[model samples]
Target: MSLKELLKKKETAIVAQWFDRVVNTYQLDTSRFLKSQKDAFANPVGNTLLQGLKAVFDETTDRMDNETVISFLDPIIRIRALQDFSASKAVGFVFFLKEIIREQTAKETQGNAALQAEMLLFESKIDELALTAFDIYMQCREKVYEIKANEVRNRTFTAFHRAGLVADWEEEPRH
Candidate 1:
């Protein structure tokens, strides 16, 4: 079978493996909660990760578009970006798909030159996904920083204004 066909056949197993890998990145308490919860509200992060991987796996390997890939990944990335994870830990789940794919296709494509080449091509798609993920992760981090700065500004504004430390106040027009 062609590499794509093999991947399509094993999509469910691949997604399950990938999801497990992503959840394992969390602390044990979080991982336990994620594993046991199924509702999207109860486990939004886990649900998003699972749904995103499934969408990715459903794409034709060669035809996966950047926008669709990013859309699928953004939710999971945003959640991780707001958390305490380093950049690698936040986006490294993309690479986990490679291991899942490799394990799933190993026996079928072993020593087969043409199939092996196709598998490499598929792996390249994963690499592209990882790059896209990094971009999304950075953007999410920037938003998080912006939010934190705004919160600090809001809390400090009243104190600074009352003490006349912050001038240039643009008072609202009276109704």
Candidate 2:
């Protein structure tokens, strides 16, 4: 069977392993909570992550275009961007899929040139996905910073107005 066929056959196991790896990036208590809590509302981060991972895995295996793959990646990256993670940490989950796939399919690809080539292509796709994820993370971080700057500007303006140091300009009447 081809690499794609093998991946599809092992999708459940691969995704489960991938999810575990991603969740383990968090604190021990938080990882346990994320793994155990199945409610979407109560565990929104976990829910988003699982859903995102499944979608991204499906897209990657199917050789979907970058834009399509990025749609699945956005939510996961956005959530990570808001957290206390550096840029690499925010986008590092994409690489976890590569390791999970390799571990899951190593035996089959071993000594099989065709399967090994396919695996290389699949890994390249994963690299592209990681690059896209990093871009998304940066965009999310930029938006967060913009919102914070706006808040600070608004607060400063309010304080100045309250202190009579700044005033709203009155429109002059036109003749």
Winning candidate number (lDDT): 2
Off by over 4 Å in 2: 156-175
Per-residue lDDT tens digits for candidate 2, residues 1-175, read 9999999999999999999999999999999999999999999999999999999999999967788788889989989998878888889989988888889998999999999999999999998898899889889989999999999999998889899887456744557
Residues 118-140, candidate 1: write the lDDT tens digits.
88888888888889889999998
lDDT of each: 0.84, 0.91
Worst 10 residues of 1 by lDDT: 166-175
Error of 1 at 170 (Å): 12
Number of backbone collisions per candidate, in order?
0, 0
